[model samples]
Target: MRVLVVEDHEELAETVAAGLRREGMAVDLALDGPTALERAEINGYDVVVLDRDLPGVHGDQVCRTLAAGGSRARVLMLTASGTVADRVAGL
Candidate 1:
């Protein structure tokens, strides 16, 4: 499967992408939300591993844009926030 990993944490993003790659999935990394949107437009990714608190554009906004744009990729949201609202919003 092709996956896009969007995270502001460079080290964490690369680590996750490397692990996914080793598992045989094609993975791409986007260090922030705007870059994530750009890549998403250019690629037909099967999945998007998105960080909720991203730079440029918020991850929630990115997710909304993808859904609104009729993307078929599944979004898996990541966040360090402990709020119930944050979790619900991502879902």
Candidate 2:
């Protein structure tokens, strides 16, 4: 699987990427929202491990934009802010 990891936290992103790599999945990392979006748009990723809160643009916006733009990759939102309202807002 080709996975795109969008995260601002370096350590967490690296850890996740390393674990995914160990699992035999190809991993790509982006530390900010714009870079994430750019990567997502340019690459054919199978899955996007997106952080809800990010610099440049939020993950939610990224998801919406990608969907609107007809991206085929599935998004798995990862966020520290866990709430019904937050999830709804993300959607």
TM-scores, one per candidate: 0.97, 0.95
lDDT of 1 by residue, 1-91 (tens): 9999999999999999999999999999999999999999999999999998998999999999999999999999989998998777778
Q: lDDT of each structure?
A: 0.96, 0.93
Query: Backbone collision count in every prediction?
Result: 0, 0
* lDDT tens digits by residue: candidate 2, 1-91: 9999999999999999999999999999999899998998889999999999999998888899889989999999999998999988877
| Cα lDDT, model 2, residue 3 | 98
RMSD of each: 0.7, 0.9
List where candidate 2 sits over 4 angstroms from the true fold: none
Residues forming the 10-long window of minimal summed lDDT in candidate 2:
82-91
Clashing pairs in 2: none
Best by TM-score: 1
lDDT, model 1, position 11: 97
